[model samples]
Target chain A: MQRIAVIDYGMGNLRSVSKAIECVADNAEVLVTSDAKLISTADRIVCPGQGAAADCMAALNDANLINTVQELIGTRPFLGICMGLQVLLTHSEENDGIDCMNVVPGQVKRFASPLLDTSGQRLKVPHMGWSPVAHSVAHPLWDNIADKARFYFAHSYYCAPDDQGSVVGQCEYGIEFAVAIAGQQLFACQFHPEKSAKDGLQLLRNFVAWNGKS
Target chain B: MGLAKRIIPCLDVDAGRVVKGVKFLDIRDAGDPVSVARGYNTAGADEITFLDITASSDNRDTMYHVVEQVASEVFIPLTVGGGIRAVSDVRRLLNAGADKVSINTAAVHNPELVQEASDKVGSQCIVVAIDSKCVSSPGEEPRWEIFTHGGRKPTGIDTIEWAVKMAEFGAGELLLTSMDRDGTKIGFDIGVTKAVSDAVEIPVIASGGVGELQHLVDGVNQGGADAVLAASIFHFGEYSIGEAKAFMQQQGIEVRL
Candidate 1:
């Protein structure tokens, strides 16, 4: 049986994320752990995170899994969600400029727009609710999921990747930002698939079946 | 694309079981909280709000378990409220799989609890729920007053002012319910709903007094609520989440149908 490790660094909504994975996993053994050996040995890894970048990195460092995760990124079928995607960038404007894992070349910045829609109605900060995400590049995870499908979002900051090729999905919240990024053996999204309903569950199911070739 | 207007189904849970009552009495068991939430999820509820009506200390564990069960299977944003007193309470619920924690009586009492929880847990996870009722006089201007203790006790705080203050205190969202209209199933108090919603910068979820599907549309269009929350209309199967979303969509409201 294939083992999938969901790295737990003591932050984020681990329970829901793990449960969503378990709901979709058939032959795969889903494990939520901070154990480096267990994560490294797993066939696939999901690095799910929430909260601020500084706190997230601190928890990761406290667990001594920084290097372990860095090694797993290129070697395993890795998935990042929300802060999991932000922390993979080079840096973030949050917490007065915190250095990230730099697995992907990018910087996370806050939504500095006037926070208004075209009609002049004030847009709520945190950007909470469902917003349609438009795909830029094709990937196995996008299979069966319609382009521009609505996904649940609850974040103030967004990722600005240096390598545009890594961006597979973009969403507009006063300003268009990368909502999903894909790379060799890696797939990351800003929205929470666990909270996204049918399309989200389908994406997770696809991730479980993906071979990480592209 | 802009954020879609949400149609949330609120479950009033008592002793780990989902129940819906009129005016906070005559409780009738709807179903298990987890199962009801799962039904809403598959039925296409934009979000789910679970309010523990009997938020007693002994029942805390049961509520947490219900939240966990629902979060695991529902696969949608879950907001849990009731009996949340402090930052610690908010932290516990979030860890238990709630995406947001709604604080009511405690927030009205301490006021600072809103800011403290917002700062500690991030404003995105802190929701301030205000229960208010309109007060009118023969020659005086009508105003809404804040109520606590499940809308039994009225605080002197002005509803609009309190809403503005709550938003300034870093509350990411506000769940505003009109006490007089609650459980009446007539319609939302558009005056108070618009008052607070227009007063706050954060998203406002207009709740209470939802009799039919048109009430929901009025809540969003007339009340200017970012979302509309209903209980009996959904809990009793008079309206399904899909039907609500369809109605909202037909009304030109942006809903994920």
Candidate 2:
């Protein structure tokens, strides 16, 4: 059976992500592990995270998985979710400016305070709930998913890729921010596909079927 | 387009079984939590909230099992509330596949629990549930106070102040319920809902007394709530989540339909 390893760095819950992938990938052996050997051997790597950026980076270093993650990013089909996407960037402004993996050349920014919509209503921080994500490029992950499809979101910071071309999906709260980013053999999102119902499930199905081509 | 206002269907679970009671009384069996959640997921609910009304520790395990089963198949954001007193409880629910855990009475008694839990598990997963009731008299400046023990005991904390403090304490969201209109079905207490929503930077979910679809719209447009939650109207099949979303959309409020 094909093997998919979900990197576990002792951050948030990995069950939902693994369970969601399991629900769709019938033939893949979905393993949640921090074992470097296991991850190196997997067909796909999914890195999911929650909580503070500094803490997440610290955890990655403490678990000795930073090198493992750096090695696996472009070698195989890799997917990142939420803080997982943030930590891949150059650096984050959260926790008084924390350095990240620098795998993706971008800065993570916090949503400006007192953010307002067109109607002059103050948009809440954390930007919680479902928002429509507009695709910026045609890729395999966007297959079967509609343009501007709503996905679940829960975060205060967003990714701002230095190379705008890396952005594959954009979502607007107070400002239009990059919610999905992609490169050769890799795709990541700021929202949790595992928790986002139907369209989310379709995205996972696409990820499973993808063969690391653009 | 921007963030769409959320429509959440709340299921009150007691000892692993889904139950609905009017004003916390006249209890009746609704159905199994997992099946009901699955049905809501198909009907286009933005998220699901399971409030465990079970009072004993022995019965709490059932809530965990119910959350796990529902979360495994439903695939939407699931929030489990009630009887969450410590950081461990939050971890337990998150381990069970719940996306978030709402803290109510425990938050009021030991406000530090909110900070500790948020610090331990990201603030994104910490939700502080507030049950507030109007304390103002007619023809007076509107005021409200937090209530505990199912809105029977007042905690003397000002509603707006508590909301701001919770946000400062790292609460990612607030589930604000109006005790005065909880079971009345007249509508939400737009005054208090708006008060708390405007006072806090985090998203607030306006709950209680949603008798019709228009009430859901009012919760967003008028109350300024990022999300609206209701029980009876959905539990008894009065209006489907899709219909509610359609009505809200007609009223020019963005929804996930």
Candidate 3:
């Protein structure tokens, strides 16, 4: 059976993510751990997190899992969710500008304050609840999920990749932003598929069966 | 196309079973919280809120188990509220698979608890639940005061001002319930709901009334709520979540169908 490691670096609760993966991938062994040894041996790696970007970086550094994450993203199939996707960028504007992993060339940006939608109504920060994500590029992860599927999102900041071509999916809150990004074997999204219902489960199933190819 | 306005069905769980009451009294059993949650999930609810009305401390553990069971099977966001007194309580619920924790009485007692809990477990998971009642007289400008202990006692705090303070205290969202209309089924108190929703930058969920489908629409269009939450209308099978969303959609409100 294939093994999947969900890296847990003292971040927020990962039970939902691990549980969702287990529910979808019955043939795979899903391990939620921060141990580099077990993580390195896994066939696929999933990085999921919540909270501040600076705190996430600090926890990753203190756990000494930064290098392990960097190496795994290079060779194996890797999925990043929310803060997991933010920390992959070069830097973030949150917590007074914190440096990130630089695994992907991008800058994480906060939603503009006093953000107004097309109707001139003020949009709330954190961008909580479900929003439709429009796919910008086709990939294995979008296998059964329809384009522009509504996914659960809860964040105040978003990633803007330097290379626009790397953007796989986009969603509109105040301004259209990159909600999903890809580079070789790496796929990351700002939305939490684990909490996104049926369409979300389909995406997880696709990831489990993915061969790390575009 | 844009962020869909959320329709949340609240399950008031008491001693491990789902119950509904008219204005916090005259309680009636609905069903199992887990099954009710699953039915709502299948009906296309955007999110689920579990208000633990369990009075005794001994039964609190039952709320946690209910959350664990629902979160395991239901993929949507689950929020647990009631008797959350400290940051530790918030942590325990999140660890139990709840995506968010709503703090009401404790937050009113100590506003700093909001800041501390939001600091410890990112603001995204900290929701400040405000139970307010209109205290203004006829022909007088509408004024609201915060209430505690299931709307039994009144604290002279202004609802709008308190909402602003909670947002400043790092609360990610505000769950505003109008005590006057909570179980009356007349609909949300749009005046206070709009006031609080417009006063803060964080998302506000308008809760407590909601007799019919139009009430849900009005909560978004008129009250400026980011989400609308109702209990009896859903728990009693008055309207399915899909029917509400479809009605809202027909009224030109953006909703996930």
Candidate 4:
């Protein structure tokens, strides 16, 4: 059984993500932990975050989990969600802008579109709800995840990775935004796969199964 | 892009557990809110709306505790209503981990409360909860009227008008429930939703009528709701959040998928 360590840095949504992982990988040992040792020893990792982007990074820094995460990427299976994904960027526009994990070479910015609808309104800020995610090619992380899965989203800022190829899934809310990305064994999604239901569970299963094979 | 439809799961949380019934009566199928929220969150829920079903004001502590508990547990953005009346209440909930607070009875009595709460918190943090009943009276076209105090007292304010006014006062979101459709599992009040969504610039969540995935799709496509909040179907495990999102995507609406 693949050991999936759900990195918990006193952040939000640890339990649901664990439950989702459990639903998919019943044999997999899904444990939520902030300890660097457990993260280092785990076969794979799932990082879920809520609240401000900077706060999430701060939590990691406070807990000293950043180095462990850095060491795992490209070697061990790793997934980041929402703030978890945002913190992987160079920096975000959230909360006076804190430096990110620097794992991905990019800056997360706010929506710049101003085009309005027939009612003279463009998309609102904090693009909430389920938006469509499009991708050019399949990423291994998306394994059982469908081509156009309507994953849950609640975000105000978006990651603008310097390397465009990293983005594997895209969602359009008045404007297109990166929904999912893959950089070697490191997979991240702005949408909440833990809360995304069967497709989400399937994605978790794929990560575990992929980890097992890898 | 057209207005996106949202599939929301309603949670009537009490002591950290989810309690549901028809028209707010005959409660059955009580489940843990944390577990149920996990179910909806994984199922592709657009957003989760939690209503404190506990009637006693004394449960404020427990309600606050539950809100903090769920917020700590779930990562998705959530809206919390019920048992919230003052700016302090709003402050406590937001501080405790809720992204938005829904106001109903308080706003009905003191329309200024909307502005007050919005001023203290950002307009984006306040949501106006309107429980409306369809009234077809002589010399008046058929329209939904706002009700307050757990849907018992009629405020006589037009539902659409109330939504618009609340927005003007800094209430950024509207959680509009149709008293006639709630708990019936029929569907949402598309007409009311369209009227309110057309009337306000802020996002409007269509609640009350949600029987199945089709209802959620209709609420977004035809109804013009930014999101759809339902309790029975998803809470009871009848329809999963992923099925509802896929259903919405199939209808040509943009969803996370």
Candidate 5:
């Protein structure tokens, strides 16, 4: 059976993410671990994170999994959720402009204060709740999930990828931003598929069966 | 805007079993928190809020188990509140798999617990639940007052002012409940809901007095709440989350449906 390792750096909601993957990957052995060896050998790696970018990076470094993650990126199927997606960017405006892994050539920018939608209504920061994601490129992970399907997002900062070709999905919250990106064996999303209900589970199931291909 | 407003089902659990009551009185069994949570997930609930109505020390363990069970079963964000007194309490629940922890009476008493809990565990996981009731003094313009102890005791603090203070204290979201309209089912106390939602920039979830689907619409359109939370209606199966979302969508409100 293919082993999927959910990298845990003592950040974010790891159990729910692992449980969601377990529910869908009936044939895979899903393990939530911070051990670099376990993560390095897994057939697929799922990196999930929440909270501040600086803190997430600090925790990842503290766990000594930073290099392990960058090494596994192209070797196996890798999925990132929320901060998982942000940390891959070059830098984040959060924590006063902290540096992140340069796996994806982009910078994370915070939404301007007092942000308003086109309707002139004030948009809430953190961008909590469900929002539609537009597909930018076809990939295996998008299978069984309809276009414009709503996904649960809870974050203030968003990614601005330098390579638009790598962007696979887009969402808007006061402004348009990339919500999902697909490159080589890497597929990450700004929304939490575990918290996104039925279509979300479908996405995870797709990831499990993807085989790290385009 | 771009984000869809949320329709959340609240599961008030006691001794690991779901319970429901009006204005925190005449409690009755609803179902198992885990199973009910699963039902809500399948019904297309935007999110689920599992509150341990009875927060006794003994029940704390029960609540933890319930949260763990529900979180494993359902794939939506889970907000667990009640009896959360300290940062350690918040950590315990989060470790048990809750996405957010809602603080009520404890936050009212210390106030700083809001800041501490938010800072210690990140603000996004901290939701301050304010139970407010309208107070009408003779010849004076009636104003809503903050109430603690499940709306049984009055805090005498101005509801709007307290809400603003909580937000300043690092509360990511405000779960605003109206004591007067809680069980009346007339609808959310729009006056208080608008008062709090407008006062703070953080997302506000309007709770209490949701009798039907229209109430949910009124919560977002009239009260301007970022999300709407109801317990009895969902617990008794009077309105599925789908029905509520469909009705809200028809009313021109953006919902998960």
Candidate 6:
């Protein structure tokens, strides 16, 4: 099995991710690196992001490995998580009027509805917690992960893909949004798989297995 | 959107380790923060809060060691508080890799400290952790009294009003805890939680009084909290990270899967 390169752009949680990958992939080696040379040769690439999409994009820009990532994703089996998925979109509502990676045709948006069950009838923003998710499509990532599998989440902004065909999973808060999306071999999930339990581990395992066969 | 509910795991880091408290006072047996963090991450914690309970006392030698170790190990966003007071204290924790530095008693006395730290480390990094209690007698308007120094002293400040003022001064998030429910685990103070969460524009992490997974859902769905924070369940091994995630998933909420 070819080693999977988990990009360490200093934005995503690399340590915990590395550990989870190690636990799941018995044969596949998970290498955390920001080096272009090492990543360019890897069979699979995974990009994970936790903070704001703008900050994550800025980190990618600072690292100067954006183009290398672009080229590799074109040929290798690539996956992006959260902000990594958003950067691939057309732009974001977060940093209003900023051009993104444009890897996918979409725009990241914040949840707009005001769902309030409070005493005063108001809810807060930055929806953070574990909630149910319904699978929208049958993709390789869902090979082991089941419908309604809970994954940890901490973001107000979500990716609304322009191409509905690319969306592989759907989750509903006040409304439905793409939880997981894909373009050929390219895949991404807004939720943090490393933090999610068995389903999350299985999701990572599926990616690893996909990388092995491909 | 309305204020979102949050699922947070409070890490009571005692002497460079994550310990569990029976009530808020009794801290005896607990695991390491790094391991607990990993477990929560896997279980699907929305956000993680590390309360350096003893960071303010004389036994404060390992300020950075504990913060850096846990932060480095987990990939999730973290809010480190409990003993942070000075500007340097905020900077040091942020430097050590904490995503947010929460201030309690400091923000009460030096209200301007909120602006100072916000200016220095960015408002996004400044989390004003407010501990409050309900003093509303049915007929009269609800009074949310603020508690500080670990619920030992009353600040005589209205939590709702203070939350509004703090937001005006540039606090990015509000970490609201119910002193009455710290370790009771009988669900959160919904009224207090609703007030603070509704009053503040930024995210409010509804904490204290989380007994089961249903409380987590209620914290978000009913209380209108952006995030929900708990400790005992994850710490005492009563629940695994996977079960929490699965339970949330069954609730029709959107979580990472």
TM-score of each: 0.94, 0.97, 0.97, 0.69, 0.95, 0.75
lDDT, ranked from best to worst: 2, 3, 5, 1, 4, 6
Each candidate: what lDDT?
Answer: 0.87, 0.91, 0.90, 0.74, 0.88, 0.73
List the lowest-lDDT window of 10 residues for candidate 1 chain B: B21-30
Tens-place lDDT digits, model 1, residues A1-214: 9999999997878888888988888788999999999999999999988777888899999999889988788787899999889999999998789999999998999886557766776777778899999989888999899999999988888999999999999998877889999988999999999889889989999999998966
The 10-residue segment of model 3 chain A with minimum total lDDT is A9-18
Error of 6 at A27 (Å): 3.1
lDDT of 1 by residue, B1-257 (tens): 56899999888888888765322222333467766776677778889998988756887778888888888788999999998887887878888899999999998889899988876666778889999988876467779899888788978899999999998898999999999999899999999998887776688999989999999999999999999998888777787788888888898998887
Candidate 1 vs 4: which has more TM-score = 1
In candidate 5, list every pair of residues with a backbone clash: none
Per-residue accuracy of model 5 over B1-257 as CA lDDT, tens digit each: 36889988887778888766322222333366776777677778888898887756866788888888988989999999988888889888988899999999998889999888776666788899999998987577769999888789988899999999998998989999998998888999988898888888889999999998899998899999999998888767677777888888899988777
B12 Cα displacement, candidate 5 (Å): 1.3
What would the TM-score be for candidate 3 when compared with the true structure?
0.97
- The i-RMS of candidate 6 is 5.6
lDDT of 2 by residue, B44-123 (tens): 89999999999899999998899888878889999999999899899899988899999999999999999999987789
User: For residues A7-101, what per-residue lDDT tens digits would candidate 4 score against the true structure?
Assistant: 98865656667766776787888888988888888888889876667667778899998888887888788888887898898888766777898
> What's the distance in Å from true for residue B17, model 5?
0.7
Q: Is the docking of candidate 5 incorrect, acceptable, medium or high quality?
A: medium
Across residues B67-169, which tens digit of lDDT does each residue of candidate 3 receive?
A: 8888888899999999999888988889888999999999999999999988777889999999999999989999999999989999999999999999999
Single-chain TM-score of chain A, each candidate: 0.97, 0.98, 0.98, 0.92, 0.98, 0.91
DockQ of each: 0.72, 0.79, 0.78, 0.14, 0.69, 0.17
lDDT against true structure, model 5: 0.88
The top-ranked prediction according to DockQ is: 2
> Higher-lDDT candidate among 2 and 4?
2
Give the share of true interchain contacts found in each model: 0.75, 0.75, 0.69, 0.15, 0.63, 0.21
Interface RMSD of every candidate?
1.3, 1.0, 0.9, 5.6, 1.4, 5.6
